[model samples]
Target: MSAPEPVVVVGAGPVGLSAALAAHALGLRPLLLEARTRTAERPGSRAVFVHRATLDRLDAVRPGLGTEIAARGLVWDTRRTLWAGRQVHLRTYPADPATAPFTSLPQTVVEDLLRRACDEAGVRTLWGDPVREAVPSSEGVRLRTASGAVHGARHVIAADGARSAVREAVGIGLDGSTSATEFVVVDVADGERPARPERVFHYRHPAAGGRHVLLVPFQGGWRVDVQCRPGDDARHLAATAREWLPAVLPQVPGPEVTWSSVYRFQLRVAARFADATGRVLLTGEAAHLLPPFGARGMNSGVGDAVAAARAVRDDAVEAYARERRTAAERNVRAAGAALDHLLAPRPGLRLLQRSAAVAAPLWPRAGRWLDAAPYGPRIRKVRY
Candidate 1:
């Protein structure tokens, strides 16, 4: 077959936008299509933590973007754990400055930055235009948009997210399983500031049954995430913060809730990174999904965009499929392990929790190893 046409990237989320930016940097005029009229302005905070490796990757595209983000977001240097009726404070592992330390910035802000960067790079971002159909051709891939406009591209990228329309149209099977656990995440306007402002608190109520709550500081107040218990009432699960906050964190005053969302844990991966025709490719949630733990979901997606951009730029579609599919599988397994470790039954995890608590304070270095080990030296380097 002749060389594929220009690359078309579906979805305008962070991953899609980043891929567009990367492709533009590589001298490819990528067309970015977004079904939504505008980028997400969701009130609730989604991802706050930016690992050092991701920072390095961002820096490759723009010199000061990562540093500016670090300045805007809060720095979390400590972690507090509530275990067995006792509050244990531990110094969290510090990120390597040379590699890029972990930083906490809202997902909206990050997307906005990427969108702006894409604009500057001359990428065509067509909002309100969704790819309704994708037909692979010898010349390139032809896409039919919702607006009845037809576009042709040498390659197509599916970054449309977990329920990707492009992936379905390409006939790529999403291979993976979903867990029964449900989680509620809320961004509250609570005026109460954490006493220890520089730390993230994981409150485990001894008497609150098996449910767990994680509280992290955000721009206005705290972002609270609670896990739903098995067979819990939906109504009660939805309105859990008001009822459980007092039991979870007795120190804070109630604040107005700004936004709330519930998500079920799903672990999914595409059967193949590229379609049978080899023109359509999947990235981000379109390729795989993982529960939000250790902030791996977003980071892994960002990594996918970076890798996909490299593949497109080099005209190495097959290599891109091989590398990214492997990476997605690895991230899926890592996220599953993290979820199991965090949400395991109290009795079953008590010993492991105790060990972490003890090791964190005693060796300090052990904490750093755990935090940074997942992102090894190989993954830190910018491939493109």
Candidate 2:
């Protein structure tokens, strides 16, 4: 058949926007469709970390977009880890102004920047018109919107998030597992930056009844993740943040909670990244749902976005399906390892952690390991 033309992208999220931008850079006309309007109220500070490679990908698609994000977000150079109120690790690195390792900002803010870039690039986005159905054939695909309007395209990139209608229409299924333990995440707006200005992780924090808590700084506030035991009530913990949060961080008493969520982390990946006809491809959360431990969720989605666009541009849709699914599987493995270490430490790992904490005072490597263990193993770079 003729080469796919007038590429259609489902969803106006960061990944979808990136796909459109990448398509534009590759000289393909793209039409973006989103269910939400421009003024939708997206609440929470979801996906706060953006890796350097993701920024590079965005900058390659549209110059200076990455720089803009870095400027708007905070970059913490210091990392601190504590075990039962005793400091196990404290290290700081020199800053590099040329290129930041990552940027910490709210997902909404990043989406805004991406949408702005789309506007500047003249990418047409049809808002409030979500794709309700997708039918693919040997030649092309046809999409039916929420308003019952039908649109035809040579190819479709589905990035409409976890509950993707397009994915169901294409008969693709997700395979993986979710944890039973719940994690409560809270976003607090801080009037001023904390004195430490570092990313901190606690193992059995004394103030929070020996539960693990992670404190990370974003552009305008802090994200606190509290790991709840199986019997513990995560929703109650989030609901009572005003009372208990101060104990976790004495520095920020009476914190202004902007958003909170109780998450049952999952490591699911789509069974197939593309439809049988190769006229529809999945990207971002539509393809995978990773635990947020190592910040692999959106970063991997961004990678999928650019790769999907390039695959369509080069007429290598099958290759894209295989490679991206492999990447997602690797991400799921890495994230699973991290989750196992953090939430489900076995007896052996528990002993190792305790020993590491005790030896950290004298052995620097032990301290470093304690600081880095929660993030799990890093994967080799894969081209998007």
| Local accuracy by lDDT, each model | 0.70, 0.87
Candidate that scores best on TM-score:
2
lDDT of 2 by residue, 1-384 (tens): 234456999998889999999999888889899999889899999999988888889989999998888788888888999999999999888656347688888999999999999999999889997788899998899888889878888899999999999999989999999898899999988756454557899999998989999999887888999999879988999999888888887667568899999998898999999999998999999999988765787899999999999998899999999999998888887778788778645899899889999999999898988887668655565332
Show how many residue pairs clash in every candidate, following the order shown: 5, 0
State the lDDT of candidate 1 residue by residue for 286-375, as single tens digits.
Answer: 988877655676777778887787887777878889888887777766666656665655675656565655676566554443332212
Query: What TM-score number comes out for model 1?
Result: 0.85
Model 1: lDDT to the true structure: 0.70
Q: Which regions of candidate 2 are displaced past 4 Å? A: 1-5, 192-194, 379-384
Candidate with top lDDT is 2
State the weakest 10-residue window (summed lDDT) of model 2. Answer: 375-384
- The C-alpha stretches of model 1 lying farther than 4 A from their native spots are 1-5, 39-41, 92-100, 190-195, 198-203, 207-210, 246-252, 345-384
